[model samples]
Target: MTDEVSISRRRLLATSGSVLAAGAFGGCLGGAPSEGGRSGLPSKVEVTMTSRPTPKFEPRLTHVAVGGTVVWTLESGDHDSTAYHPDTYGPNRIPPDAEPWASETMSAVGETFEWTFDTPGVYDYVDTQAVCTAHEQIGNVGRIVVGNPELDPDAQPALRPPQSELPRIARTRLEELNEQTHSLLSDEATTSTEEP
Candidate 1:
């Protein structure tokens, strides 16, 4: 019994320590998730949950190197970090062998969830809370593109699920979200060129 208790305590401490380290390092790095030392990892990137002018992720689309991580920080509204998988209803966008992850739908500001991309693939995720009529199924979705240095981000970002297969609201929202991403990318390209 004592040994079991000690093991549990040790696990808890280790988990807690990592969480704290992630929080501190992520905060310092402007909200990106912290990763254990690894090669080929592009620095972590962040997707923020915003409630002010709109309830949505700050960067709905993210691109990272194959071994990178994406951090989702909940600022408001009930939300969770959920990967697209058969369990979540699909047209799955993740790699066939990628493990799915989800966070409990909670509204606590500063709550964060992180996932590391090991395989080069497109990963679509969503906030799994039913705050809106189609909250978890629609506008709450985001995309992560884990690209190989040798190739583009792969089929991840473009592997959107069949819109016609979803409920009307979800389909409409998804289309709108895609358009927003398109516009955002276009804007970013223009901005980048202007920078020089």
Candidate 2:
């Protein structure tokens, strides 16, 4: 009787362990669930900020409609989102008519800040903290392209301020994002033209 009880207990322990391990592994593989809004025109999008090890923005790039809003969620450490405009002590990378925006420094996890893009253009921004941490030098930057705005010949970010100031990694990231934004705009243009 004692031997039988020991065997059953061991089997139960093994089964429970397997069940827990499988649950954890499955969750890891599933990734974060996406919460989307509208069809192709998301009303709101989120960008996560982290500062441990290094300060960075997850996704680094975001796209939204002209009136869409972007919410920055702090995941770790401190951060602030500031557009690259003369008013912010950075080059003019946002739309020529768009107003500069800067978020107050946030230090707690789960803290949030948001901005609405009312103009149609590509906007490049950085964490003002970059000045002290050299986050921009290390490629920690964020870009947002609103609507299907036509690219300005003379105001292209790749050829303007900050681009030359950024290091290889930051410049590379911007280049890749610029290509992606261009492709997206091109595709939207094609789609719109075909619709009518």
Candidate 3:
């Protein structure tokens, strides 16, 4: 009985020693430091969405750094990204003529789409699906502004209407008139002010 007790005590000590050794090794490998210890590399940023931000079926994204990548992960339903420029290459799997940078229709619940912007430019995109009648009319659209470090010190990204198809003169005049009316109502007048 004494011998058996001795063996059991030895086994318990061995097990406890092994557990302590493992914990020490994990700490050396940077596992949950107590304080002031360096961690590993930075993690990637992820963005999620349920539906298009625009009434026209477009997802809106703001400015990101020149080398940064924007990943649009669809958490729930179907979606796509159709760029305004037809001449430029778009989502790799999609056809060239579809859109400048259009992504294929993503129907799966966890579908993901990513775009990396290297050049400095303002890119506009839209969802081509016609399920919503007023989608495009009500502005189901998004914009991306890629700015260089030197060109844009403040990195002030902005969204503007596409310049390729200029607004009709009549529409422009009407917008101007509306702006003037608003200014008059607000009692703020300035001849150089422009419509947004």
Mark the regions of model 2 whose C-alpha exceeds 4 Å error after superposition.
Answer: 1-39, 130-132, 155-162
**Cα-lDDT of candidate 3:** 0.43
**Residue-by-residue lDDT tens digits, candidate 2, 39-133:** 34455668889976789886677766678788999998778898888798467778778888999888889999999888867888887764467
Name the lDDT value of residue 156 in candidate 3. Answer: 17
Encode model 3's per-residue lDDT on 123-196: one tens digit a residue: 45555545544233434455443432222213312122223342353234323333432332233123114323
Per-model CA lDDT versus the true structure: 0.62, 0.71, 0.43
Which ranges in model 3 have alpha carbons more than 4 Å from their true place? Answer: 1-47, 52-59, 88-99, 132-134, 148-196
RMSD of 2: 12.0
lDDT of 3 at 168: 50
Give the clashing pairs for model 1: 122-156
Residue 81 error, candidate 2, Å = 0.6
**Model 1 ranges with Cα > 4 A deviation:** 1-41, 131-133, 149-163, 168-196
- Writing each residue's lDDT as its tens digit, candidate 1 over 51-105 gives 6665566676666666777888888776677776778645565766677777777
Instruction: Quote each prediction's TM-score.
Output: 0.60, 0.71, 0.44
lDDT of 1: 0.62
- In model 1, what is the error at residue 129, expressed in angstroms? 0.5
Clashes of each: 1, 0, 8
